[model samples]
Target: MSSNTFKQAAEAARSKTSAMNKQSSEAVSAVKNDFLHTPVMRAALPFINGGISGMVATIVIQPIDMIKVRLQLAGEGGTTGPRPSPLSVTKDIIAQGKALDLYTGLSAGLLRQAVYTTARLGFFDTFLKGLSARAKAKGRDVTFVERASAGLAAGGIAAFIGNPADLALIRMQSDGLKPVAERKNYKSVIDALSSIVKSEGVTALWSGATPTVARAMALNVGQLAFFSEAKAQLKAHTQWSPLSQTLTASAIAGFFASFLSLPFDFVKTRLQKQHRGPDGKLPYRSMTDCFIKVAKQEGLTRFYRGFGTYYMRIAPHAMVTLIVVDYLGWLTQ
Candidate 1:
């Protein structure tokens, strides 16, 4: 063939290949859009599943969590007598109340999880949507940084709003009493707030605000950023079902986040448990004081007394919740 004819033939072949590639891309895009846009019948599945999983996990680990509180309050100087290991603590709780004591605060825990998960997950979706809308109004895209900031803000707000219920739940769990018996009966979340205000004062509701906020920030960032990345990567690289992918990603994120925030949790539990002096004031007084006291009294290792239980509870909780939530969503769809 002549050189000009050969060149024309090559151009024609290239054009055909490009056209095919574009068509293929468009077809894939359509499939994805359809799958995503279809109305899932069980959109509420994730929230319900997440709440149940969290409640169950909390109950299972309640004893260890109780021990963690006791150890945290003992301070850094350490326990006065022989220190009980996690296993010993577990045995003690079982002996004290048997299975019932092991699940001392089951009702409170379930309530807390139901409220917290609902608010946290519900508000997260709402905040992201609001941010997206705001960005669109400004003729801008919501960047990763913006999304992260939104998560932080949303988490903080949710934590604050949910703080009182959390405080009551913790107290009820550690103290194992309804407010009425303690002369601080909180019939509901609002009743708890009012009772605390009437007796301990409004500030009592925010006993461990600092640590709570910090934990919230860590959790939100971990879940939003890590979950998003992990889901994308898993879908792209693996052949796992969506349920498996969601559970694995959520479990990894929850474990790391929960582990990182354990120290703060240790402090928060201590601060919350410490009795007010005869004058009705907090014993530790402040976060710094609590930290110094724990370090000086209990030693560094005390900060991690229930590490194993923490991991066990969080990993399964996250995995189960995320998977169930996704499954519910799929079913509804």
Candidate 2:
């Protein structure tokens, strides 16, 4: 009697445990299904994927970006200043501090990508779908002009929204150029942002918004529009695999992006890096002013001073970001 009772109790316990496990699994599955099927969640996936992809790419490319910024800012006031190569900039950064100095504004860079890429890529995808649908309704394919317009619009909107983070990134990266005593020594992106808002105004957070937006528009047109175009062309004309097509498309996009945006990017860095002097006057008044002054004084080529480094930074970043985004989209699909 005792043995049977004990066995019965053990069996009941096992049965209850199994039931609980089954219930938990069902519950998890239900939740996953809801997440996948919910309109809001589905709508938000592109932005989430874009941010994650951009952050991953930024982590890999931050050092190169740092060097690129340094190169752009090297001969600031005049064309006769030292011409620093990427190698020289890398060495100098290491000499000044450590290898990690090459990632001086990483927090700001990540923040910038999180906001900027999320919005731009999400908007681009959304716009592309709408355009494709319309074109399909008319029994036609999406045109390059339509793609470029979508990219430009997405970039402009995203840049405006992400200006604060972009400003903080430029400030942090350029801080090391200041005297040790003058450096704010921002501990993080938040610190840099708060400091800027405290010393300057909220408006100052968008110090280079004009150039930033312009650069973003140029970049998006080159990167997004050209990538789509290249991929379409490759698919239609070549016998390349999907991976080959993507890689080649991304490379083409990166070059166009770097070339088209460098001038605006150069202006953006300078404008964002500037602060009011003792007289409360900033160096450059606006995007146009900066462009003019730089062209007049520093020579027009100053805008393209770091083309090679910029290309290296932009190309790899574009490749990694697009690849990761594509993979993520595939997974989600």
Name the best candidate (by TM-score): 2
Candidate 1 lDDT, 107-130, residue by residue in tens: 556676776765666555556667
Question: On residues 1-333, what C-alpha lDDT tens digit does candidate 2 reach at each position?
Answer: 699999999999999999999999999988887887699877888899999999999999999899988888887888785778889989989999999998999999999999999999999999999999999999999999999999999999999999999999988998998899999999999999999989888988989999999999999999999999999999999999988999999999999999999999999999999888999999999999999999999898889988998999899999999999999998776
Q: Give the Cα RMSD of candidate 2.
A: 3.4
CA lDDT of each prediction against the hidden true structure? 0.66, 0.94
For candidate 1, the lDDT comes to 0.66
TM per prediction = 0.70, 0.91
Clashes of each: 22, 0
**Residue range with the least summed lDDT across 10 consecutive positions in model 2:** 74-83
List clashing residue pairs in candidate 2: none
Worst 10 residues of 1 by lDDT: 177-186
